[model samples]
Target: MYRIPFDRVNWTTSSFLIGTALIALFGLPVYLYHYGANWFLVALFFFYLIATMMSITVGYHRLFSHLAFKAKLPVRVFTLIFGACAFENACLDWASDHRRHHKHVDHDGDPYDISKGFMWAHIGWLMFKLNPEPPMDNVNDLRKDKWVMWQYRYVHWIGLVVGLIIPSALGYAWNAYHGLDPWIGALGGFLIPGIARIVVAQHCTFFINSLCHTVGRQPYSTSHSARDSAVMAFLTFGEGYHNYHHEFQHDYRNGVKAWQWDPSKWTIWTLSKLGLADSLRRVPDSKILLAEMREARRKAELHLEEIRQQQQPGQCQRASDKVHELVEKLAANYHELENAIAERVQLSREALNRWQNETRGIMREISRIQLLTPA
Candidate 1:
């Protein structure tokens, strides 16, 4: 690998990340032959993955970046600790970069601009310094958070302690209890959940940047690279609904539907029920309906535009009657499309009304219960 003079490759970041890749690639095969993995180590792999991942999805990304919902101090602390263990960056830095990504998207100032290519967006942006100067001006809101700021100030030390040291210690302890040699246990901890887990987890985040944008449907917004993808949601733990996230950035839910794979949304809601989170943000159904209608309209218009281009004056000059027939058919189809669009909007409006009525009934019931109970 060629090193550039101006590239602000933070050696701390590059060394650990690159070292992990090397370990996962070369070290894993050697280690597996010698000690082999046990059920306990396998369990650690999943446990740490979920714990650290939620710290980013629920903590660093949504809670800090978008402020989709308010969390209790304990929740924040939990997320902060696990989030640091993920080793992406400081909470402030991650949130600041995310806010900029949303604000600029594929245009200038987007740190991971997909326009540069999928590889670039996925991981290259981190390896090389694209913006040169870090943008502190964007995240003024997060600055007010004492915990977030403190995390940013000591993120490097935090990463070292929480990310590597703790996992390694836990691995050694687990192995020691099983009567295995201390060195083998230490090696297992350092490699399995420590390095391998980080490698896999980091790529999941990268997939959101690369695959989520490249592969999904943009039912919510075609103006950006973001798209809605269920496969991605499965892999990235519900961050795959990029289209909705880009369109409704403030909404606490990524997978808004009942069946959508959004564990993050579930976590936030569960915490809210426990009084650990509150003011969960949700976009109104009416707004979502309107966006759907707009998208349908855009699709129809695009189809019409393609037809218009194909039927240029010179292309149809030899077949006047055919052109007239096509025109009549198109006119009818256009009218039908218009009517369909209207009907879709009407159906959505009715559904929204029904939902609202149901919500009101629930609220009233809750209010009655509250009134009956003494504070």
Candidate 2:
């Protein structure tokens, strides 16, 4: 029999996850049965969910892991608290693993390489030390931040207090004031939002690893297992644009197009305006356009080749006609896009947004043209 390596097991994490899961399964249902749907606490669950998830997505993932922008002390502290509440890990640990994931994605060295399978990437990697120890060398910059380090030292206790104790205390007080059993409020507020919320949050974060790789289009680069799923983006607060993310990991925005939903990007932008964020990084439109156009051309060529190898002569001719049309239109689109980007003036945020939308329009038109000559 293969003996369990007890030393290698992250007992603290394993016990917490199992304890919370059992509460979410057994405790939450019991509380709901007794309270008959405390919509108020349910709303609080969602509130905590959004807050903590954003802390991880915007604060930890983007701000800390990628250093996509610089945040003020308050902003950094805010992210650290709620990020701890997310209970994934300390910001240092989380960012280190994530940086490795980016540096060596879809490879054995990738912390959550999707090649291992969906479940493994989503949660199995966390079941044990399946991933190698993340090198601290990758996150030397984050370590320099005092707030990040403070949170690192007290992360577990911070998670318990901010994620559980506080909510439970408030719930108990509210219920006792209303002359109801304090335990009822405690259960609904603490267990549901505290434990259950972690489960839901973990999955939202996990979806970025699993669903992002499994379902979606790779418009920027197919060099890795990443892809952009708009549906997943909405679910994960805009982290689902994995294809663009993998292609341009340093870019501040995953949903680069103006029309896409990316609350995380918007939050960073908003903070900058409020002077709580600064030094926001962005990939120039010219570079983004270049990558998209190249990928489109590659796909078109592959499709044409597949069509050419087929037996149907009539189908072959039709496909050839469509391919030619696609190639011609794509070249035109590329030139127009390049010209627009080159002639751009002092671009304000609104101008930048408008420019992105127009670029997206041209890309969409190219897509329509490609469909006209379907393989």
Candidate 3:
């Protein structure tokens, strides 16, 4: 177990994290029992939840951290405002840590390195100031953005007012207009939409660092701990395709597939259409396919080698022969696939399609061999 450094404890962050969670846990049930699910309050909570979570995932993570897309002032302002409400940190600090995380992922510099432990990655890192404060020199580009600087100067004030006070005021007004107790309504709003939403939204982001690195499929690359999870995507508004995100960090979309639930990707696309965003970076389909093929080929080769090693000298001659044939086939097809892609600029569409089809068939065969291999 990792020891908590009492002297290194960040009292402010620790208090906020623990206090908000405790209030949400204990206060929410009491609020529900008294108010019996007031629709206005419930709607407010959902509204805050979606806004804050989206701001962090889309704005702080994608726009600021990775520079995945360029946003107009309105989009930037909105994201920064609610992104602050998530209370993760100012854009400058958040982006700085995130850039370091990618530049030195899973190594000493990663702010929330999962190798440390699930709890450490999830929240312990934030609770305690175990490491010395690193300079924000990485965010030189962001430092030029006036809006980001403005938010950095007053993030906590914005968070307190827009995140908590505004919701409470709205709740009070709603109750007053409806001839109900405004005081109770205000308290309910502060507790539910304000505090509880923060706890949930913050955890959703933390899960990307903890659970994303711990479980899920790493089809793209195992070089890093990052993996993809549909459940995490759902919780985080489509930020859960961690494997793909790590593999192609500059791509605007985490969920790279057509059917993947990446609302952040969709939002950026929609913003582009509306002239609110532009310069959305994306990894080409060919490149993505190449990555998949390479990983698949590598896994197949490992499985085949294992099967060959396991085969008795003469007892499993047939299986050994089959493994050799599959290995030859895999190598030949993969080589051809690479050549075809390399000459894609000069190749006709028809020829590329034929090569792709042949490669897919080879991959299917490789998959079968992999499945047959004993765990």
Candidate 4:
């Protein structure tokens, strides 16, 4: 068992306790009361959820942490401001810790390791003072930007004022105009949408650390505990593809497939098209496929080895041959898909548009076939 060090006790903080209490007290009550059970509130919540999730995935994770894409000044600023409303933390702090987490995943240094426990990974790490001071070494890239620095400096205050106060004020104004009870509007708008949103949003973002690591499939790399879960990805704006992310951290899109529910990737793509973002980086398809192929081969070889240890020499050889045959077939299929994608990329706009639909259908069929095959 891993022993808890005495120094680790310093990790706990009152902010964590207070934050948890506030979330439970305010969020649960409002959520139970309004619960957005109706179509209107449900629609509103969905929009809020998408916006907030994108702020974390696209803005904080991809933009600030990995520098996977560049956003226009206004877009960057807007994301930063709205992201603060998620109540995760300043972009610099969150990004720094995230970089560190990727650098030291599943090790002693990883800020949130699910092996420690589900709750610890979800929120306990945030409650403690893991480091006496905010991590500065991992955040040099963020320090160069003045806007980032400003947000980092006053994010908490900004969240309270803009996320909470502004909403409450607006609620009051609406109530006054409509001749309704301002308190009801304040509770519905500010308390429900503002504080409750923060609580839920924070947990959804944190789930990637806890649930993603513990309860998903590791198809890409088994070196770490990170895994992929479609359900978690939906909650986290496509961040639940933890295995692929651990394998290829620099890719702007987490859920690379079009059908994957990655609002973060969609948001960045939309922004890029509208000239609000640029320099969107992605891992080359060749490299990604190569990694996947290598991992699959490794897994097949391991299974073959296990069988060899248990079976006769002749049987072992036959199993090994089967594994090799499967690897070769899969590799060839992947290469064909890659070439098709490349060809599509070279087509004219009209031709490309026409080919994309057909290509997507073919790709979907290929994925279905691949999924049916044993990993």
Best by lDDT: 3
Please estimate how well model 2 matches the true structure, expressed as its whole-model Cα lDDT. 0.82
Q: Estimate TM-scores for all models.
A: 0.82, 0.86, 0.93, 0.79
Q: Residues 115-220, candidate 3, lDDT per residue (tens digit)?
A: 8899989998899898999998999999999999999999999999999999999888888999999998889879889999999999999999999898788878
Over 1-375, each residue of candidate 2 has an lDDT whose tens digit, in order, gives 967566667777678777878888888888777676566677878889999999999998998899899889888898999999999989999998898899889998888889988977987678778546655798888778888899999998999999999888878887898899998788677877788899889889989999999999998888898999899999999998999998988878989888888999999999999999999999987668667876776776666566566635444365456666666666666666667667874445675455455546544544454222324
When summed lDDT is taken over every stretch of 10 residues in candidate 2, the lowest stretch is 366-375
Clashing residue pairs in candidate 1 are: 227-243
Ranking by lDDT: 3, 2, 1, 4
lDDT (tens digit, per residue) of candidate 4 on 187-258: 555655566666678888889999999988876789999998899898887899888888889888888766
Q: Please, what are the lDDT tens digits per residue for candidate 1 over residues 317-336?
A: 32333333433443444344
Best by TM-score: 3
Backbone clash pairs in model 1 (N, Cα, C under 3 Å; residues 3+ apart or in different chains), count: 1
The Cα error of candidate 1 at residue 101, in Å, is: 0.6
TM match of model 1 to true structure: 0.82
Q: Residue 190 deviation, candidate 1, in Å? A: 1.2
Better of 1 and 4 by lDDT: 1
Q: Single out the weakest 10-residue window by summed lDDT for candidate 1.
A: 366-375
